[model samples]
Every structure is written in structure tokens, then in C-alpha cells.
Target chain A: MSLDPSFVGRTYPPTAPYQVGREKIREFATAIGATDPAYHDPEAARALGHPDVIAPPTFPVVVTMAASRQIIEDPALGVDYSRVVHGDQRFAYTRPVAAGDELVCVNTIEEVTTRGGHGFLTTRTDVSTAAGEQVVAVWSKIVVRGEA
Target chain B: MELPTQTFRVTRADLVRYAGASGDFNPIHWSDRTATKVGLPGVIAHGMFTMALVGRAVTAWAGAPDAVVDFGVRFTRPVVVPDTDEGTEIEVSAVVKEVTEDGLTRLDVTATCLGEKVLSQARATVRMAR
Candidate 1:
């Protein structure tokens, strides 16, 4: 099925608030093999003038993944989840994500195009704190395989 | 161990090798003219590849490459690798910021290109060996 052009500019409800814990930040950093002290040590971050342990920029993926459920599961979109691959990812940040912050995500379908029997879908998630302070915008391109 | 500040002369070859190792082959990484056409100053390195190098620096510092518990970074700016005789060595490094009660290690990371930051507001964590 073709993507719904009408879905362009559609916005999903903000995801449930997620608290950014130092340990979780640490876990994310470690899982990706990062060894930055600022990710877990408040003092180290404070020395750099950060209020707390600062989360790495990619840390927003946790909530972004949850927020994307709305887009991938949209019955109108007709995306085959089984054949999807992560084509690309990027983030534009207004500020670094810090620990101890409560944040949520709002995802918007930016574009949908099909080529060579493949569907290319782009999703942008605007991530921010519950207080509405924007942290970053994550853009992802996913390609779905054609039906055999 | 005292943290080291790194500066690299990254050649196009380095970027290609990185793509091979990381499984990220975004054309923007290898095609110079394509990169210029895309409004980038020049070909830039993948943000994740930069993150991976920084991750390597951190894990090496932690005394175990596989001991890191988590790592992530945001791409604030793109590292425009210039097309020159040599290339670019992404100035990627980390500073030990703190150690938690549970003994997790935290480090603030930064990667720069030609004096401009490519990945900013970055951080990582490593679990120390007992």
C-alpha cells in the first residue's frame, strides 16, 4: 500500500514523561561503548558548568523509539515492519540532554516516498522536557522492502 | 591515567575504513561532490563513526574495550572533512568528569573538525573493573 500523503504534518501525542536518570544515561553510554565522565559524574559535568550528568546526544532514541510506534503502526501508512532497515539518522540539538530531566517526544511524519519498489519514510521527532524546553530534533530515514 | 587530547589528520581513506567497520555507508560520507552539493562545506564524517572513535578512546582509557556500559552522542554540527593532500583526523577525545557511588565512570566527550565542533554536548559511561 502507498503511504498517505495526508499524514504529512501529522503529529502524535507527546509520549509519557520519561525521567533521565544518571544510571540510565550511564547505561546508554556504556551500551554504546562511551566512556565520557560527564555522562554519569555530576561533579565532572559540574566542573564543565553543567547542572548534572549530561546525557549523550543520541540518548533521546529511547523516547523517540517509543514515539515512533504511532507512525509505524498507522494502518493507513501500510509499512511492512519486517523488511525495514535503518537508512540514516541525524540530530539537530538546541542543547545537550542532561540527566535528572523529565522529557517527552512528539513525532511527525515528514515525508513518504517510494522508489525501486521500496518505501522510504522519514520521521522527525521533536524531543523536549515536560516543561517544553526543546533539546533536539531527531530525523530518521527508514526503508521498507518490497513485497515478494 | 591522564586523559589525552587527540587531533587527527583524517584522510578520505580513514572515513572509508570507518564506514566499512561500522556498517554505515551513507553516500554523503564517501562522495565528495555529493557532499558539496548537499550544502555541506565538504565531505563530513558520520556522527556515529565519530561517536565510535570517541567510544574507543573512552574504553581504552577504562582499561577494557568491552567494559563500557553505555554510550551515545548528538550530532550538533557536521565534520566537513576537507579534500586535501592528507585529510582530517577528527579531534575526538574525552575527559573524566566523575565516578558514581556504584563505581560507574562518566566522561564528557567532544569531537571537532577544522576548529568547528561536529559532535557537541556528548557524554558516555564506563563500568570500571573491580
Candidate 2:
């Protein structure tokens, strides 16, 4: 089923604050083989002007992906999660996310369209500090394959 | 100018670790049965995992962990992972697209697996080291 075009521009409520942990950053960096010292050592990060060990550039996806469940699971929107495949991803950062930052995400449906019998949905997530400081904006596009 | 190329190996173990770290437990990335059921050839690497690998390349090129200001990619193909210890390899290379007056450098990146492009329209902007 095609997504509702009217759902575009619909914004969801902000998610609960997610406290960024140093070890989590380390674990994520390690998982990606991002061995840069700044990702694991507070002193190394401080040398680069960050308050704590900074997350890798794509780290925000961890939070945004979880936050996006609000839209994907919306029965009204009718997203077939089983048929969904990631199509595109983009991130614009206001500042690097560092450990100890309490983050919140505000999700919005950016676009919804149908093409070639497939449903395409785009979602934008604004990530910010719990104190309301803007951190990063994340965008994701997913394609729902038409029934064969 | 072209930057040095970066390469990464992707094994099922890496996918499992990435799934744990990123909180994306999508069975398609680990379970071959689930993947084939989904019409996928076999167990595949997560799109975010491939993006993260490219992100590593971007930061490494910028010479600063916090240098990336913008990054994006289109997932054009799947990096299918065979159940093998050697796994598959992804080769990442980039060219300097522009260097702004304000010290931001833009890069056009390419990532390929098995000699097939897996990402397109891949790019990154970073704060250049002073």
C-alpha cells in the first residue's frame, strides 16, 4: 500500500532524553573499527575541543533510528515494516555529539510518495541536547516493496 | 586532489557487533534464513553499518574526529556477506570536491564491494585542520 501523502509534514512528539555514555561511544566506535583515540579517550577528545569522547559522524543514527519507530509503526500511516528497505540517509551536524550529552529527538515525516508500485517515505529527525541545544538533523528514506 | 583510499572487511561477526552497538537487531543482517525469506540473496550488512564505515573514512581523511559537518549516501546495492571468516571487503576512496574559504572541505566519496558500487551520491563536508 502506498503511504498517505497527507502524512507529510506531520511531526511527532519529542522522545525521552537519551543520555550519551562514554562506554557506549567506545563500544560503537570499536564496532565500526573507528580506532581514532578521540572516540575512546576523554583527553584526546578534549584536545580537539570536545567536552568528552565524541561519537563517530554516523553515531546519531543509533538514536534517530530508535526514535523513528513512532512513524514506522503508526498503523494509520500503514508502513509495511516487513517490506521496508533503507533507501537513503543524510546527516547535518551542528556540533559533534560528545559523551555525557543528554539527547532528544523530534521526528517529522518529510515526504511520502509512490512510484513504480512502491511506497517511498522520508523522515527527518532533529536531534538536540536535553537543554534544547541543536545537535544534528538526520534524514532517512525507506522503500516499501509492492506485493509480488 | 584525491585522498588516500580506505578499505574495510565486513564479516558476519562485524554485523552482529554493529547490530548490538547500534540497537538495530534487524534479523536480515544476521540470519540467512530471514534474509532469504525477505528476498535477499543472503545475510547482508546493515546500510547504517556501511555508512558508518564510510564515516570512518571521512573522519580519517579530515584528520579530525569531529570534523565532519555533513554526510550523506544513497544505498544503491546491498553488501551481501557470505558466511565465511574472510567475509567481503569494501573499498572507499574520495576526491576533494571543494575547499571553502571558511575552511570547510567537501569530498565526493565512493564505496564498493565485490567491485560493484554499493553507495552512490555519497559525499561529506568537513572542517579542515588549521
**Estimated TM-score per prediction?**
0.56, 0.99
Error of 1 at A89 (Å): 0.7
The C-alpha local distance difference test score for the whole of candidate 2 amounts to 0.95
Among all windows of ten consecutive residues in candidate 2 chain A, which has the lowest summed lDDT? A1-10
Candidate topping DockQ: 2
Error of 1 at A110 (Å): 0.7
Error of 1 at B119 (Å): 16
Give the Å shift of residue B125 in candidate 1.
Answer: 22
- DockQ for the candidates, in order: 0.06, 0.96
lDDT of 2 by residue, B3-28 (tens): 99899999999999999999999899
Q: Candidate 1's error at A79, in angstroms?
A: 1.4
